[model samples]
Target: MRYLVHYVEDVTERVHAEAERARLVAALAAERGQLRAALLQAMTPMALLVGPEHRLELVNDAYKRVSGGRDVTGLTYREAFPELEGQPFFDIQDRVYATGEPWAATAVPVRYDRLGAGLEDAYFDLRYEPVRDAEGRVFALLSYGVDVTEQTRAHLAAERERQRLAAVLEHLPVGVTFAEAPAGRHSVSNPAAVAIWGVVPASPEVAAYSRDFVGFRPGPGAPGSPEEAARRIASHEWPLARALAQGEVVQDELVEIERPDGARRLVSLSAAPVRDADGRVDGALVTSVDVTERERLLAESEAARARVTAVLESIGDAFYAVDAEFRFTYVNRRAEALWQRCREDLIGRHYWSEFPAAVGSESYRMHHQVMSERRPVHYETISPLTDLWIDVSIYPEAGGGLACYFRDITARKTAEAAREAAVARAEGARAEAEQANRGKSEFLAVMSHELRTPLNAIGGYAELIELGIHGPVTEAQRTALARIQQSQRHLLGLIAGVLDYSRVEAGAVTYRLADVPVGEAVAEAEALVAPQLRAKGLGYAWSGAPPELHMRADREKLQQILLNLLGNAVKFTRPRDGVPGRIEVACTVDEERVHLHVRDTGVGIAPEQLERIFEPFVQADQRLTRAQEGVGLGLAISRDLARGMGGDLTAASVPGVGSTFSLTLPRA
Candidate 1:
């Protein structure tokens, strides 16, 4: 066997290997201890041997100085040191015998009693192993230790601080997660990270977001996903990308992360390189902030740019918009065609000054209308050269000069003269007589026929359903027939309202003065509608309705109005998967008037035509005159009926979201 004898290099691994030779106790053939000693003597750490039974067999002299020069030879360890037994001193020897393998045991708190540790300032990393003779027979076990007390104490302090730091991470206001390098396993996470994970917990770990190197989800996809983003990163030779692969320190940088919430969060990630004592690369340290709200505000500012572009494209007439000098500023599709110029050519040229001959007479009136009125003004004049009849209007622009809208009306004037001559010749006397009485007589006959037909059917069905003369009705068909009967009654009320509007117009409508139970009528109407509301996923609730609320009114007419309004609210309200959409009916009283309001988050009315919505057969949506498959007479008749009962109906709306129709009546 060769003796190594001198320390020359980085000694940590060499010392550990030499220590292992003592563990091959049962497996030793011959000269194992001599061979192990030779191997250990060359380690960069100073080597030594204590006797198998606990006396110092030899020292490398480095051990003597560190151990403070105590002559340990031939002395029994447990006798000199009674504390060695409780510290598993025997197990360390026997572990070598059984497995014949070395196991590390350090920081057992051995005092350097003889080493001038008078101030209590030293510790060691001690090991025990079997020693073999030259003939490969077990002769003794060797024990050794190195002074590692300072390193051990520092490790313990660092562990304590690491645990405290992990606890503080749990209270982090923003999400924090760590991904280990190489494997990219989830090593640590804060409470905020857990919550954000729950929001879209498709996968348990954020490893899917890691780059080819050791980096977590603080990555962004600019023109794409991870693969495409990495390609861009490689093309740009990003420093973070290089550091993550090699475990180098990387400065903080912004990245894009697409969250499962379908939002883009801009994040800044910073990683610092971690290394072993030998300075070999180990891994990195990575940190994400949500910047979606800021980006959304920026996007909204861009929308205003789109609105400006839309205004420039919408003008349809033979319009000319120009600057202070009458230089053409913008021309839409038709305006470009009329000026006989391409958009590229027309945009920068002078319009009025280009044809300076035409500006003095007819063009002056067009230009004056905009500057003086500061509003759109219209006039008819012939073009000087073309002699074409032009109806022109000029609107003053916010930034500058005039925008003129003019149309040829030469044929219209000639047609008007012919019509004037024709009107002068005849027909005024005969038309006035037919227009006054004929329309009224026809409306009364239609109303009488329509109301009487439904009244007869309603009366006949009431008689039959009551007597069971039509045979036994199925439960389903009986429910249907009941709805039909209810509808017929509602139809009859509409006819009565039509008659009421006529009476009001002629100042003949009258009221039967009496106190009626308003709640009883509202309850009856609710019961009739409650079945349909339940079938169609509509919610029905009543509030501020006293059990015996009294009012001076016609009972049948008030019930009809409540039924119509509430039914409309229910029918228009849409639902999804059997869940009711919002429709609320509420009433409030302040002693003067009982305000009944039906509001719905259903289809609403447009603003322009809300004023005349109460006129007979005049619906807010005309092309959809029967869009909902209903006679539009309901609201018109309801208004007249309310006025007849000394009440009023008014509506307010926001298109697409909802409408609220209110009925205010004096209380008895």
Candidate 2:
């Protein structure tokens, strides 16, 4: 009973206070659970890392999705994302935790080792906030992240495109320049622009453009002065400046520029104003191409054309030109006189219309042919209007046209006609002479045949009486018979010569042609003439020819020619002053022909009479009482026979010297 009196004085109050503290603790735990649930279900990616090792203490569903649905709640940050070891995210998280400072980054790049997706690259807008305990000492890190991969990639792609366009614009061959709107301040220029201007202006304003780029409008004649030229193409007149001020496009405006180096250049400029989305002028772009060489060539071409025109006007002949359409393009002074019309009436007019009478003429046909075939032609025609002969030449030009030249040839044509008339008169006289000669040959041929019949009858009667066919004969009667018979033989020989001459003139004799050996033919002729040579006391010599040497001639005709030649040589040669005359026969051969030469040291013929001796019924000595026995037809007959056998007889002689008779024939 005494021990039970312990201090129970306020124990109930202490128990009540303890119960209130327990309720407060339970409420706080419930609220913390609700907060955790809220964090895990959030749409944003969130994670909690605790301690120095950065163990992943909590991760939301959005965070798990970003990690390729990987369960990494109990893993350290390094273990969950091993691929991000070298990334700035790992170091940044450590720094945030160590400094107990909140850190944030936009478009930060990260690499992750996802569960089934392997390694992946992602961009994010991330924030790291430090979690502190009651003492304000950092204990854990809270990571808040937003996936900005698509947005960051789009922005990067736009930046790369801008850089590529800038590279292309820098390397263009044609000069390019850009200037800001309104003020026309130079903002961008390629290397080609600087090269064209020769120098870059120190100032970027439009007013300074002409300081380095002095220019003038292209036109004839020279610019007055440098200052005047600059004023002519001031900043306001420049194509680029005009485009910026007026919002207009200017194309292919030619400008002659004077560089700072004193070199002049011609440029073709094209400019247009750059527009903003609201269709307002924003800037101006310009392109320039240098055309100095091209302009110089054009000037030279004009000068060459003028020179050609002067040459055409100064030529002697009548000249005209026609285009491909056959319309007259030019008519010279001479051409105008020849056409009997002024150049104004002929030029630019159709050729046929100007000269209608020339249609269907040879000149017209040839002109058409020259144009169609692109060839040159020359022809003669008589003008229908003037009736004068003209020699016309038409030449095709390279530039689809024709050039024509004309010369008057009426005097030449008249001379040719007169010469043709004289030739006709001479031909008629020759024809009449040939007919008279043919009649003479026919008369001699008839008389020769008729006279031989009576001469043969007389020879038969004389021979019969001498043989005592009719009665007995004495020595006187026999002597009388011999004289008559000798007279008959002489008359018959004359008739035979006449007959041969007649036959040759009428072409009635036929030759028996063969390859006759020249040596054998000469030997036979020499034997026949041996008696005559002996009688005249003349020396005769034969120059032998090769046995194989032959001539393509008639054998009988060749023998006759040699006999006549040798006989004449024997007859003419005689002893003079006790020196006997010599007759020599020689033969020579070439690759295609043979020559038989009979030379005589005798009474040689005069040069004027040599050719006459071979004419019909002609003689060197025309006296009636000539010493020669037979008619003077021997040489003539021989020459005709030689020619009939495809050979020729020619004689060369001097009055006091010897004579050479050469007979030429084809060799086999």
Candidate 3:
């Protein structure tokens, strides 16, 4: 231990030297790593180092940025950029490393494929350069890329805009033109403008066309541009010329241009001053709308209006029209004549002001109603202004107004009033006559009643005498008493018939109506008249009666009517010219009514005397040669009673033939 310690010099210096050498090695390694990191990070292109197995060995900040900051270290090129797999980008990178050459592409497109990366298509200029070691063999690849999406998009958009503008100018409908200001020198014209002017601007100047080709402003006595310009200078002052000269906008100006083929066209023109970059008017832009069709339509409308005015002025009836405000718009000559004023005076004046008295009249109200309801109204009113009756027809118009057509009817009204008065007087006289007849009927009825009492008493006394109730009678006396009884019975029948007829005419008879069997009533009526028929030696036939036929009537009235018809047959059907008398009674039914027909083969009534036979006191044989005993009151009474029972009696007879009396009653 003594010999080891004797020559020990301080070894701290050697230890320091070793430690410094180790520290210098560490610092150099760290500096080299920092420089490699800085160099990779400074490149803007997506850069990464790949090993021989194609796995990512190193990644720079630019690589992370291109991958949207995803962790792609140690991933193969196919795994790192999955969207570029099977694409030229991977092949290019491979070729650069294999061939030690550089490849560049313009506008190379790529897409990022990662979760939450919002991968969209990106275009870029890409360059791939092989990175080689000192042996000049490629070990890895370097990629440089620049985004060019905005520049590419801007170029495409500008091309599309140019195409749209060309299409719009080619297909425009209206005539469009641009010309130099104040000089009328043409710059350009659409196809429509060329066609409208009938000539393209051959000299590039509107003034090259003759004055006949240019549109001119309308002047007095010219509906539009005439065959010749109003003046050469006047044509130069048209819409386009004025806009360029004055630097002002000219809109909706009407001008007429004559084509080279001698056709006139009306056009509405609009123009505006075109400014240069310095805001000074250098030219004019003009447009034209063809108005030839519109001009023709306006001309036709004017002609139609004139015709309508002529018709109104020549009409016979009064015609007038008013607006919604009750102001008069038109009045015809007839209306003016009726008003005793000129048409010009009535037109444009308020209706009430013209005819103040008509303000609240029926005509005024009707006019208002027509306008409000949008329909026609017709009425008759008397004008207080003229005290004349007017017949008015009011019609609604599309413009919220009413048109009135009327005529004076005072003459007709006066005639109608006079006729009405005459009719009223006649009605009064008829009523008085009816009352007088009713009085006469009542008197006759009373007289008939009084006479019947005495006549019946006389008949009773004569019958008693014939029966020898007072004393025994001789043969001649007995004959005389029989004659007296016959006379008394005949007088009693006359009195009864008169009373019945009077009652019928006076409307004093009453009936109890019911659905009565027609057959039964007919049988009873036939039985009542059977005795008289037998006494007159007449053949009576009743057949063809429906068993269930019913009529809505009074049973007694029906029977009475039948009896009267049968009695007449009995009286009139006595043997005439050795022909035996015959009578027929029939009952028939239809859907609406029941019919009872009584036909007699007798001395039929003459055609002239048949109508009078039913009148009271009238007889078919009124001459002395006639042998009928009773008056015609029976037939008249029977007819009236039939009517009261909802039935009518009609008679048809032919001389030397037969008479048919039909009773028609409503069927139940």
Off by over 4 Å in 3: 1-311, 373-377, 576-578
For lDDT, the strongest prediction is 2
What's the candidate order when arranged by decreasing TM-score? Answer: 3, 2, 1
Candidate 2 local lDDT, 270-319, one digit each (tens): 88899999998998787888778778888998999899889888887889
Weakest lDDT window of 10 consecutive positions for candidate 2: 211-220
Candidate 3: Cα lDDT at 214: 32
lDDT score for residue 27 of model 2:
80
Tens-place lDDT per residue, model 3, 267-386, is: 777888999899888988888777777788888999999999899889889998899888899989898788888978878899888788878877768877887889897888887777
- Output the lDDT of residue 39, model 1: 40
For every model shown, what is its TM-score relative to the native structure?
0.29, 0.52, 0.55
Residue 619 lDDT (model 1):
67
TM-score of 1: 0.29
lDDT of 2: 0.83
TM-score of model 2 relative to the true fold?
0.52
